[model samples]
Target: MTDRDLTALLERATEDVVERDFAENAWAAALAARRHRRRTLLTGVGAVAVAALAVTAVQLGGADHPKPTPATSSTTSTTGGTLSDGTAYAVMPQEGTEGQLRDFDAGLPSTIDVRARAEAFSAARPPGSVVAVYLRADGDDLLHPVLVAGDGRHVLMGDVDLVRTTDASGNEATPLGPRAVGGGGRYVVFPQRDHVLRLDAQTGDTVSYPVPAQHVEWAGWNAAGTRIVARASEGAWSIDPSTSRAEAVPVVGGYEGTFRVTATDALPSDVRVTRFDEDGRPLMSTPVRGPTWSLWGETVNTETLAATGAFFDQNVTSKVIRRGYGPIYQGLLVVEPSSGAAKVLLAPENPDGQTGRVKGCCTVLGWADADTVLFQSLGSHGRWVLAWKTTTGEVFEVARITTSAPDDPVTPIALNVGRRS
Candidate 1:
């Protein structure tokens, strides 16, 4: 086919695919058939025409038309086992289980803790229960009291207060002095200037440190607890607990968004920084594209750039390249650290009150492993479904969990999955 014809055909096919709302599978099948026909036409054309036509085809298709490696089988399984309540669990790839889902009758007071750092943390039980939970605590007061997991079985607790107390004796407890706190085992108290103490939840050890007189904010830890990110008067800074090394990186632009050190070392590449004015209006927006350093392997992938807003905003931009299929819109694209290949997972469309319309959105809810990605989709009637995909393209439907009440929207609490041990 001539280059013009090929371009026209691809565009028409894409438009049709979108209008019909073809799922990823159907889309792939249709593309493959069209590709075969294009190849056949190219073969039948004369040699003199082939040279010019081939170049045109290549240019029109862009460099993203290389055959994508088929998705490999994933060992990761996302099964929602029965909870203690005898209700079948709806499992997502997540770190810990929800206690509320397991036993609604039980009134377990959800525990919260303020970690020294603000990082992505996961909570899960040993096994034999469907009460795993994971949560990202950004510093927003409205969402501050958010419950990561309320399932009644295994509860992953967070957002607790660091308090000060005294003994039976009238002697006043110094701010830096160790004190016992209820619900906390062996509390280590540290001073944060003005009679304020910093306590470590994981370890009871406490220390005295200087914090600004004004309200102090806690960011989370990096992959390693060695580095803790915190916000103070000067802005955000990374503090190395071991070496006491502290350095200020550029302040993250968001007001109250969660910060997570991805399990992999992929540093934020292709950052689309948007600065806002005092009135929450857009002032400036710029895109920074570069190689992102991976945290796990420490390798860098310059093949594609990832995007995030520089300052805080509700929406962010992202890019993903799908082989053979070309670029798929509104899908989450993640590059495998091990193979350095990109995998594009389609997100469901917004449900516009149409049954069987296949309206749902997908997010890289969490990582099942370095190679496997766990995704969640909300089907019609607010039903929740979980699926797993590997870098190689294999996709499997794990289970259908539950639906959110129209009154109560169930935001993803936490997601983590792995091969059953």
Candidate 2:
């Protein structure tokens, strides 16, 4: 094919991935491009091999195509298995689309975090805004707080970015912090300099409340979603998102309440992770045997499910990767809260059988209760999702989500689980 022809082919593929709402991530797009490049390289590697094998595009149809069907959930006994209290899952495509998984019937109600912008259909601007949830897709270190909703009707709140990043050189940009949605899907408040953006989940309406403009140590809604709390240069204060009111509460010592997640690299040979009760009592302390460890969750929302990231056998992995290997296997540990014991739930990442692609990043979303933890794998054709049981170490199949557009490319995006009232 001509160079121009190859360019067109790549563009077409990229368009397909994007139209499919696979992932809105630049890394994911790069992966799609690299996959295409690898395919091209493989085609030229051997002529005799081509003659020996012939494969077709993914299809199980005669006339057009048959799509993937969501697998029904199978759980182990509740004695320690993933809880199936009819928990529903909400997904966000990398392309900025959001919706609920009707496939296995999460059985429980779900609410998703989103930044709702006030846009006018014909010029009169709509009112209000919403919340943001930072997610680490695939195994990427960067966290994206993309806005997503449960109904699939995503509303862009504004151009304001919602995630913070610190470069390798120690420079930080977009200092957005952690935020949470209220119980029963009610309201949440996001902080911005002098003004706080508050929005209701059910309605797209938003209200801006004023606050101290100085940079705060941290800002987000309180656990109850009743007010916006932050530790400004002066002290920690809680502001009612509705009234733009502030109260001088005791400045939380960085982390508040019982610390659900803890990381200690005190020993180079053995890393440790521990969960604690609200009173600072250690619940479970498990030591991890690896080269590095990174904790992702604070405290358990309902259970002590936590995800830790690390690069195993660093020197060997680096050597292997330098030899033109696809990539080294980054590891994840799904730890138990009570005993502090841990298990490597996901070994080096691999391609999903259905999508034939791997996640650009491997990260844990949250728990499905005390027994199950949902993982966000945006590596394959679409966003690959899996639910892992803490006790049985069994990974349950969820949906591989994407846009329905015929030509859109699909990549994994972020995922969050919620329960209904």
Candidate 3:
């Protein structure tokens, strides 16, 4: 088909869809950058047919017909419910089961009484309860940030206009990062022109931290969960949530317990992980070889690190080469950055599966405890937040996200899992 013809077809096909544009190239670049940022860790962690069209693009671009299968899941007696931060989820008994997963956006109101709902949540809910926030679809070019709790509670945070100067990069969509839900799940931060807006879910209060530039991107909390990390026009900064004090930091990485973790490419054969003390002094360096991408933190202990990566052969005899650096042979990689030891914790039956689109097996949400790491996986089964036990190799479905249609605006922009470890 001609370029104009394809454009017309796409427009006609998406007339009833939301007004947001889903450019594959743009999204791929964004996804790649996001994946790169995943390796640089502060220790954290689509709608659209754009859905059909993107898949079609992949099929047209490659001839590698790799059959994909779901990763093995352990059904052992796993119980599901609310987490410590009031995030709710279900336990999947089998591969195809939805368990207690329901449409999180079902019956969502177009408008919400932010103050009253916040007051109600504060009064009725016990301590340690915070509502998760999501950027819901609104009209053609606007997004509404809604607060969600595990008990099916919903609160509208505010509306963000895409056509305006809300984002410094001029991108209409929300910036993807760990800061969407941070502060131990007690807060959600987003950008508003020159300041970083912080929503205190526990108290139904909002605080603004002004920056020097128009668009300030937040990186969530520091290793200690006391300060917020961010980057703006000036440089990298660490902000104290209590006093709203912003301090510039030379380098930012992940912290677990007492150690600060960072990684770099030493040579083509391996990536070097360095451990630093609280005073920013390097103590040790370990080389890990073969992981295409590695993420640190989200571990039961500081010695172990969790990551997602893919592998490929140097030579391909097929007619069509993989067109882009899309998702390939990927899985959950368990790495001991301190010892330079690495292994696959879980990998899809087909590493080059369709859902592996720029991400891998899943995105590590946080460490649920010393033994279990929680992550959101997209595969043949569906989109799910699962708990994987590193010691036992058992997988428990924590929650399954349900969307009404391919173009449903209720699509989740960010996911928050309470860090219990």
Candidate 4:
């Protein structure tokens, strides 16, 4: 047969065998199906995870998509079993958040024995050595103060009012909140007009100490947790809760040993950090670039004179950032007080509040150890407590925290730097 005739015959045969090309459509449909199935499975898994957190008391984990290496909780519980892993930080639920969890039939107890809880927790860990001081919503305006150890043993302190009210002098006093926790985790303080109510976590005792000034607000504890500081209309004062002696002192930041660290606001191109002695003398000063706001909080390493910084934007003004900034930056920064060296340790891809990403990449909770800095991160699973080794730059998930309130997750409060073995 002629070559042209043979080709025509082959073409006719091909046309008769093949009707239409549905390969592209089939592939697209298959991809869509796979994605849908994946999403559904993840959702189911997430729901189960949430339920587990509610039932098990505190079973925490990281993102459902990118699975993180599970670590045990920093604490070793006596009654409760060991936590999944130790990337754990203290978290506070919003007022309505825990209430919503109860509404969802999470079986959360309405009333918990505050003293019994504290005693149980103290049995597992010692006083002044806590991992976290958090507020748990209890279907009221008052949030229950909880003392959580590294092993996940928690003590629920009775509720206290958080409503902002004007003192006798007509000055609006700051509302009592999670920040009222003492550095050692041995005590939790709240302002009550002319007096401060201090709760002892070990003995479940409450003491009221009179303040020299009216409308005093809790300013947290000194770096050593030995003295409780409060601010008033007149001035700031540091009180020795042991002796009930209150003395006026200059407002200092992160006080540790004989030194303290302070940073300027997010107004200029660089933040001026100053280190001061216990007597309010400037020892050293350094300028750190980046960090529009230091909302992530700072803690100083006394031995190295280095502090942790969480910045919203690098070298950006607060005014510009507030006006709807784009591609904003958020990460962990380490600043040295003596050498004036600032380094960005971990810079995550997406900014804060980005959809389909970690809620916040890193917020410095405090140093888990001398070398490991513990920070909190939020993802699809829940809030995760992560650890970063400054010496080796090794980062890993320490603990996963899924609160009873899944929709409105808990926010990490100050981390208890003390991790007992």
lDDT of 3 at 400: 47
lDDT of 4 at 105: 11
Q: After superposition, how far is residue 231 of candidate 4 from its true place, in Å?
A: 3.9
Per-residue lDDT tens digits of candidate 2, residues 1-421? Answer: 1233222222211000000111121111110111111111111111110000000111111112122222332222111111122111111222111112212222111222122232221114321222122222222333322334333323334433333322223332332332344432345444444455554544545666555435443444443344455544444555544443444344443222222334443534344544433222335445533333333312223323444333344443333232212443443454433443344432334322233223223444444544555554444343434554444444444434333342233221222233100
Model 2 residue 142 lDDT score: 31
lDDT for residue 140 in candidate 2, whole number 0-100: 30
Most lDDT-accurate candidate? 4
Candidates 1 and 2: which is better by TM-score?
A: 2
Of candidate 4, the 10-residue stretch with the lowest lDDT total is: 50-59
Q: How big is the RMSD of model 2?
A: 16.8
Candidate 2, residue 117: how far the Cα is off, in Å = 14
Candidate 1's residue-wise lDDT over 133-237, tens digit each? Answer: 222234422121111122222222244333222222222211111011111111222222222233333332344444333333223222222233333333443
Candidate 2: misplaced stretches above 4 Å? 1-104, 107-151, 158-179, 191-196, 202-244, 248-252, 256-260, 264-292, 296-301, 308-310, 313-329, 350-360, 380-382, 401-416, 419-421
Candidate 4 residue-wise lDDT, 1-421, digit = tens: 1233222212211000001111121111100111111111112122111101100011012111122221322211111111122111111211111111201111111122222234333434444434355554555334455665434356555544343324444443223322355534556666555566776666767776666766664444444455655555455556666564554444543222233333344454345555544333346555544343443333334234333434444333122232212233544554444444344443433323543223234545544444455555544444555555444344444444555453443343444332211
Worst 10 residues of 3 by lDDT: 48-57
lDDT of model 2 at residue 273? 49
TM-score of every candidate:
0.35, 0.49, 0.55, 0.55
